[model samples]
Target: MATYEDSKSPEGPSSYPISHTISASDESNTNMPSWDSDDDPKNPYNWPTSRKWALTCLAAFATFLTMMNGTMATVAHFEISEVFNISETSFPHSYWIVTTWALGGACSALFILPLAEDFGTRPVFLSTYLVFLCFLVPQAVAQNYATLVVTRFFAGGCAAILANTAAGVAGNVWSTEWSRSVPVSLYILGYMAGSSMGPVMGAAIFQSLGWRWIGYMQLIWFAALFPVYYFFFHETRGSAILTQQGKSKDKGNDSVGSEKTATTSTSSLRNLTASATRPMILFCTEPVLFVSTLWSAFTIGTLFLFTQSVEQVFMEIYDWSVTQTGFVQCAIVIGECIGWSLNFLSRKLYLTSTSRNTEVPGAPIPEARLYMAVFGGVFGISGGMFTYAWTSYPHIPWIAPAISLTMVGAGSVLVVSGVTDYVVDAYSHYAGSAMGAVATGENIFSAFLPLATFSMYNNLGLNWASTMLAFISLVLSLVPTLMFVWGKEVRARSTFMNEMTEDGSKRSDDMV
Candidate 1:
């Protein structure tokens, strides 16, 4: 005879049958997604630990390589400026390195992320990442400036799959509450390694090899990570993957997206068109998603804006050599690493609290992540900016503002991790679509900001320019705060968020 609990407790089954003994916890219990898929023994969530960690490492590696491509030019910006014969009055050409890639990722995420619903993660991911690598070949060997810029933008477009959707993969792959920490650590570690690698690695290469080899270095990383992706990364989306596996078990119809495609075989063309346009429709129509995207985009824009502008401040004012300049640049990556570490700790704390309070439970508010958002806003952007801005003068020791640099970098970590975690939690279904919407703005701001950074610094001077951008970041940080506090109400009012909040919304619609 099987046993069941008549009395409810906050914590339920620790094993396969999560549905068998679920506690009636939060008021939004009416809107919870089916615990059925979540409890499926055959689900990827139930995969062996070795397999899951393998996949996590693969994502970490791939993410590292892609990010390196994103920031490879930062340390080399001075050399790149001279090579292009750009005017002394404007070194805005440097912005193209970051902005174009951001724009590309934004444009592609708009459509690609939503495709997980129809196509599945593995198919879309392998296809996009492999194809994106081709553009780098031309970029490394480009004869003129225009060609490199255009190809970089196209490469960034392909990166949308890797960067935007990786988090969702992390969320979907595990069952433990703080399982997110493992992936977050791996991802952040890869990110810091990549960003820091650009300068330290670049300095070494410039000393012995050529700057063009920096692009080739990415190719080496590509070769190493590609096989890992092919063999290890499995489809982890709860709805699409599980539904298909369920079909194999049922001996009935094909999976959801499969069934739709098969039935509409004669009109496959029409089906594909409709599916492709879904994210674009989501972008224009949704409110909760749009707001989330706005916050994500602004955060992205500010990060790149700091990247482009900071190099000049260090080089011109402090008179640091390329290698020393790169060390100073370490503060950004250090800050991000610190931010991720705190987030990891915060997740662990939440888990501990949940474990202790057995009778009473709480809904996982998106704002649970917002405390870090506040830190990122106040310290990372505003305070860090002020510290760096007010003291950027040549007279003061360089290390003073340099120490403050870590705050912004660290704060940025919170901003990114918090918004990412919150939006995915709040709008689980359309997290990708919402991300796409916001990324579109983010990449645009990132790309466009560099175009004017030189002029702004020229006219405003270092102190005022840093102050101005700091103030802008302070104002925009409120966006996330409002969402965290009132996001539930906002989601209730919007049709877009309705899809994620309601139980019946189609799960197979998300892109991998």
Candidate 2:
């Protein structure tokens, strides 16, 4: 029998830690396989710079495609409604075509992400992507609404893996905080950009090729990339790699315990269950996490809500055609790009604050991450919403409301990014569970918030409806500032944070 020992949790070591491994055998002295050194080629963190970036870009592009699929169907809602004999009064039902995609993503992530952690990212990614593509075929040729909705649900479930795991892939290769931020930001850009561009692309395609081609184009693009993913994407999870090494070393040895088998279904199930539950547990128990996630979720939810509201606002107030309305989404894309660039400024502020804090020389001050969110919430989201609401009139140039979207987009990106960075820094190794909590809230908001689009616009009118959301956002926007002011005190009070600190101390002591 082979026994493996390491101080790190089964999820693997922290990004900064030195690699450690030890082996012992009951019947003989044999060296178990492990990374040869910190510079081992088998370790993703040691991969060449070019190779690391290539894979990161590949993962980012994949995330873009999956996110785009969620909203590319937005422009075609009218056509889909017509084809299915759905009435204008049934707008909410037709909206489900888009909503279910997000709903599926939300529900499926709890299970899919856990599976990726237990297995390896490469296998789970390839397998889910294959399943996603299979489901896409039905959407292209579906004869009934049921087929379309059902297939999209399953497809979105599969697509969730890419959006959630792409950043993890980037983190696998770049272990440093600042360097890792670049690729992580790239992935975040891909996500926001994809959502913004989907309607634009869908409109052009719908104008020339019609609604069916939207599905066809997705099929073609996803299929073409399948080969790229299969050929180039490699496993990045460290624990999964180590487990494989252990299995290869012990293969064909009957004395090896069943519990030691890396692929044992029983252990995998336990991991999956634990992974699925921990996020919710943390979410329920952690006040700071709950507030931050709720704020971030509202911003994300607003982004999705725009898929419907933007079209309606422009078509009604600007008298713009569907194609013209689709182009308006470009403003959001431009804003997202600007927001991406602004992250560098946030990083600079973070570094400056860290340098000034002599209490812990190299420790991150998580509150510094909230600066962007403060600017974004106050100026970007709230200010933009107020501007967009009042300027939305046929008498007012469409450009006014359109430009306001830039603020909304920029603000949304900043808030989401700031909150994510703070969670990662504050929670440390438990960041995954903290993030899982955030993702769940964000997805749920993305899924359900849009259901009220038409009702809100029609009942409250554009001015009040927009103002209502803006006010809500204004209130939520205060969260980041509050966190920035009291984050240290808040974190000190957290049970999860204390546990993380204690565990980290134990690991350091073990190393000493």
Candidate 3:
């Protein structure tokens, strides 16, 4: 199949020196058969819009399910505490379930994506979801808390790929920078909405049936999607496709066989090792990755922190039932909806701003992606934190805090989409590695924030603890602002990003 770059690039004048355009007699002597031209029917980018959307929706659903399962036990916190005979002195034990899940996600970010790149996304994607499914039974029928927690850890590890790799899938489908926003926004909505809605569903189920049903629900839902995904999702990895093409050609021709084999094996081994270590190295070396990941980490960590504590606040301060508290968390879903709507406007702004530059391949400014994040960080995140902190008095109407929750939700989505898009634009072919680095930071911080939340509230009180978060948000707000202003310089200094650009350009030329 022709590469995504082929579909996105102009067909005639810009696609210079295409190899497939050789004469019929010249083509017969070629060492390997590739797509006939840039318009190859088998190229995923050339696939019908209906098929593309189907693939995207399935990927998004998988992402939603991961978060749903991760947060399923959240609203069941009280029930689990009671079942395990946990005490206030051992309160952190209750949170260990959440922490362990995050730990698994963090650990998986280091290796799962590398495996995907080495093997192929289809098999790795299928295997992880199946492994995640197997862990659910142990969680649902555990004889003790230890068994439940251990199973949750493995489930989280398996599910981690959902969070990190869905964006890569989105990148696989959408070739142009302008085409990425809506699909990426949809992906973010799935993640944030599932996270918020999970607690709500868990609250109702735990209240009516029991905590065990939460696992059953996840299992049932995953079981339904597994077949849909396995049957419909086509392979989108370019290198994997090329390797298969080479293998197919080897049966008919022997001249290029040894050279192809040696090159393929060596390249595969190097990519595997690089994918395994690049994220870690980038976290330390790349300013853009470091700063963006830190900002993303805080936003996501704070989201998890809120997930753990929001129920406690509503129950105590408003004297609300579990069902009532669950309804309140719907504010997050509302916020994500609003965030997604705002993304449409932001995308329009992006298209209009970059319209002239689209004719020039590989030159879309990464800074453009951060503009929405600026609005989101300052008003959506900082403003919401302050509002929630100040308006949470027992005498205050519950609506006040709910309104604030919307801002937090909106800001979280904006930052996620913005930074993710920026990193992908800046890194191009190495997007998965850069994103894995960011996901690692986000998950690691999220794992620890729950432990800090209870103490923060105890020592600082609800309003003050939240105010502290607001202050931190205010400080981190500069991330998007700085990136917007100076991102070009940051990209200029990135050796990895430069390497990817050079490598991508070479691949684009070779495929043509």
Candidate 4:
């Protein structure tokens, strides 16, 4: 709690720092630096209530727009085909309406991370939203598939930026204790909800009006959101914000030659370097972030595969309606919401005084959040796979697969949320790169998953193909548990995590 950065530097040859079970909640004179917002007026943690919610809403909305844009095309594919005058049974070509945006978003993730540092997260965020919405106009007005594809490509890039930036926004707004995972989980809830809701909305709009109405609705929603983000979502880069505030406070009071005093250019360069290098460095260099990101990417891919995979079973076995298909998708929503809600509650519990030391003696260790990741994700992933795999036979009831989808949803949440929280907490300052690793891989996996899903299911049959997916998920689910059991040693061995520890000692605040 002294500070993520220790005022005293280590004197020996790269020895590990001491670890302590600090009382996470008894922040009063607790030798903890910047533990509470009341301790520092300029700190994001200390922002007024109105300001706090403003930022929270912005983060949620940013996540929402990213997600809404990601999935809205699925419902519009029918309209797109008619408008473009194309005919194809291949779901991929039709799915490209959604996949194009997904590909663009996935590709953009590699760059937006480092950019977050130099520009400050707020500017990067608002600009991406505007860009995505702008591309829609051309699509809405396009005369051919080429134009639509191109428009979707660029617009998807904007969506990627928005989607990838969710971590940066959360990191910028919250402390390690107030970290972004729950908000991320909530926004994910919005995302899944939007995916389900967008199609439903698009269907209603298509019935009442036309598919163009889908783009129109999104345009309207983004327009309203863009301005709100500009006015709120205060910068959360600790060094950049503090460095600026410190300069202002130091103006005219201190000599021009003090060690801490410097021109705006110096701060800009540092922020830029911190933003660009650290996240990439973490991805390339840190084991924890890498593994966590991979775990997240794998889980998200399998979860999304299930998004399309369910239809194969339902149609083949039960011969359900399109409405019934959409309704089945709701099971994922139910599961994800429940999983996220439970984790959110756990996070809140860790924040309480009595729950602090009594739980994980380590404040922010990956182990701290493992309660759900292992217990929920591992079992849920396999259980859902097993249930869905064995139950989709023609003889089985339709409800069996729906129940399995719900389990897949819950398992996905458990895995994604837990890994996400650890990365957000562990790589607080370099969240862009850390999250970038995950987001980049995540969308890549999500985008490419369906390409293989059909062939795999076709060749192996539904039962075996699904079982294959379940087997993969089962292996990946063990990642969190492995970390939970050996995370401390993993951190100890990590070059980046150790380097980031200010005192060369581990602290709960730093770990989280």
Point out the higher-scoring one by TM-score: 2 or 4: 2
List model 3 lDDT by residue over 1-512, tens digit each: 11223333322100000001101111122333455567776655576788778877877777787877777687777777788886656355677787889888877766654555544457778887788889988878877889888888888888777554554455565655445446656777887787777777878777888888888877888888888888986666544454476577567677678776676576656665766776688788887788888888888888778775686678779888766777678898889789888887766555454443332344334466678877888889889989998888899999999999999999888877777766755665455566677777877887898788887877788888888888888778775677655655666677866644443443333222
Instruction: Give the TM-score of each candidate.
Output: 0.78, 0.90, 0.86, 0.77
Q: In model 3, what are the clashing residue pairs, if there are any? A: none
Q: How close is candidate 4 to the true structure, as a TM-score?
A: 0.77
- Stretches of candidate 4 above 4 Å error? 1-42, 82-91, 163-169, 176-184, 191-200, 230-290, 345-365, 424-431, 499-512
Q: lDDT values of the candidates?
A: 0.59, 0.74, 0.68, 0.58
Backbone collision tally, model 2: 0
294-369, model 4: which lDDT tens digit per residue? 7777776675565456666786788964435545677876777777677766565434422344224544333556
Error of 3 at 442 (Å): 1.0
Model 4 CA lDDT for position 21: 10
> Native-vs-model 2 lDDT?
0.74
Candidate 2's TM-score: 0.90
Tell me the spans in candidate 1 whose CA falls farther than 4 Å from its real position: 1-42, 81-88, 165-168, 184-200, 234-261, 264-291, 348-361, 479-492, 496-512
Residues 1-512 of candidate 1: C-alpha lDDT, one tens digit per residue:
00111111111111000001111121112322333544455566676778777776776666666766776666666666678765555456655766777678766655445444344557777887777778778766877677778898888877656654453455455544445456655565564445444565665665566667777777777767778778777776544454465455556554755764565353434534543564467667766556655665665566566565766788789877765666566777777777767876656443333333222233233345566676677778689989989888889999888777788777776776666555544544444444444556666776776667778888999889889978877876766677645656776777655443442112211201
Ranking the candidates on TM-score from highest down gives 2, 3, 1, 4
- Each candidate's root-mean-square deviation in Å? 8.1, 5.7, 6.6, 7.4
* Positional deviation of residue 264's Cα in model 1 after best superposition, in angstroms: 5.4
